[model samples]
Target: MTVEFAGEYFPIQPGGRFVVGREGDLSIDDNLFLHRHFLEIAESGGLWWLANIGARLQATVTDATGGVQAWLAPGARLPLVFATTSVVFSAGPTTYEFTIHSSEPTFRETRREREVEGDSTIGEVPLTLSQKQLLLALAEPLLRRDGTGMSAIPSSADAAARLGWTVTRFNRKLDNVCDKFDRIGVPGMRGGAGGSATNRRARLVEHVIASRLVAKADLTLLDVGETDPADAE
Candidate 1:
């Protein structure tokens, strides 16, 4: 079996194990938010498996049928039931894509029932246009880069100013938004002692992008007539 990501490839020997993370056996150095050893891929009994090794990060696994099989939370493991399985995840502001490949015929059979049945419930959280605008404002820094090559992440006050809102109102609305995500079981969207406000913002953006709750084209909703393209820079 082979694992490929970021123009790099790792081949797994039969009955061998591969660790993936910033400091794992198969180190992915570019993703700063990954745990030292986030995930493990092992070949056992002629079948390949992927396991999340107690990492706070979240992963999405899709089977060969192009249907989502599971969202691997920390310490979760699932079989890779396909000749080629795609895993999509994010570490902080950077998104990562990796693929696992195997020639074994055993991998073609789906053994587990899909666990994404709750996905339909995610859309039940009704969001107002103002709430969505705030989400887009918070996410803009990570999704788009500036010309000067500096991070575009704005302070809460700056983001509030961009939306013509006061800091107090902005923070109140943000809390409400986080509450909505919490009600629906989206990880990293709620504020707790686990991380700082900036970290929460990054994770929120990661989740929104990963779940397709927001998209680049949705930025148009933030625009008023006579908006300047340079402002997005």
Candidate 2:
């Protein structure tokens, strides 16, 4: 299906489908493109789910378990806010209900399904596959720059600019990266600023040292535990 949202065309499914834009038309793989788009939305802001096309038309997600997820898909021309769940959507017969689940979205397949006895529900909807992809893509560069000599955090805006993104988009990518890092227990993401920077630097040094030792492990002349004066010189 060819879906048009906010005057832009995006491929809805697999085929020789493309989304024509000012820069150029992009061929989209529905399974993969949504994930990438979600990241793009996140990079522009900490959250991308709010910007979904289904957020508008006063869409409400009600699962059989009575879980209510409400959001507004406001057009992209408006300013950002938390008041409404905004989505830029195509003019289609919007389906307020879906069989989608968060577990079926991305790499979160391990999510355990819960059954409410009477009605134990939360007001959260199933996140799109696009959103998941966005998160994964955001984690890559940030993770690369997190360990060893790359421990220093870079300006997300600068990185976004290099990728032809606006400043807003860059910040969103940084937020997604941080969230992923926290989930994976990479450390340093949630520490005090001054201490965190110092700790990361120290870890980087240790990592480099360990790597060097491993590289020269075959050379008996260079011992990892030795502190010989002759070897130092």
Candidate 3:
């Protein structure tokens, strides 16, 4: 991940999987609330967690009638320390912000995008810089955040929030992604049974193309001249 501070973009290459923040349990008076510039996704499909990137959030609590107020600071991880079993999260534009108070405050943010390395089979196809950026941005959230596979169809709301688009706009961008995959002949990159095989193939092609191999037909990997591992026996 890259963080830009004072005109310098520093890459924070995690030695392991990246964890946005730490999580723990807490009592009712300690819930965290926040708001941000982008869209926020409230838990859907029986989920119990939520969070966002570069987001501004405020936390608080309320009584049974939903009348209460307590403001939380931005970018601080607050424990879900409360007794209100029901909590509400409001996700909208930065211009409008809201809050929810409850006895319990634990929310999980699901995946909404994915990342594909350069040097996959799909690396040979051509993609505009913007197209590539949007693709990675959308795919990473789905895989890393939501923890869904390539074949799992995620809700447009999730995609829209991550891409910073309206639901309608997100659907349009998604169509473009699909079309690009089709043009490149990358199968799972087009959204099929995604796994290491498909991901590797697509990423291989994509990497080659992005790096400008120039002669499409002449591109080939150095021969390792080894038997397939599965057949070594």
- Candidate closest to the true structure, highest lDDT: 1
Candidate 1 residue lDDT tens string, 76-145: 8887667877676767655565778877745445487566745464436676777777888877765554
Per-residue CA lDDT of candidate 2, range 50-142, in tens? 233222233222222222223334343221222222221112211111122122222212355776588533422222232222222322332
Task: Give the deviation of candidate 1 from the true structure as CA RMSD.
Answer: 7.5
- Residue pairs in clash, model 1: none
TM-score-wise, the better of 2 and 3 is: 3
Per-candidate TM-scores read 0.59, 0.22, 0.25
Off by over 4 Å in 1: 1-4, 7-17, 23-25, 30-36, 45-47, 54-75, 82-123, 145-153, 187-196, 224-233
Q: What is the lDDT of residue 7 in candidate 1?
A: 66
Ranked candidates (TM-score, high to low): 1, 3, 2
- List, residue by residue over 72-172, the lDDT tens digit for candidate 3: 33453333222332122222211111222322334433464576866665434454433443444434422232223233323557644654557776556
**Per-model C-alpha RMSD:** 7.5, 21.9, 20.0
TM-score result, candidate 3: 0.25
Q: What ranking of all candidate models by lDDT puts the best one first?
A: 1, 3, 2
Candidate 3 CA-lDDT value = 0.34
Candidate 1, run of 10 with poorest lDDT: 142-151
Ranked by TM-score, the better of candidates 1 and 3 is 1
C-alpha lDDT values of all predictions: 0.71, 0.30, 0.34
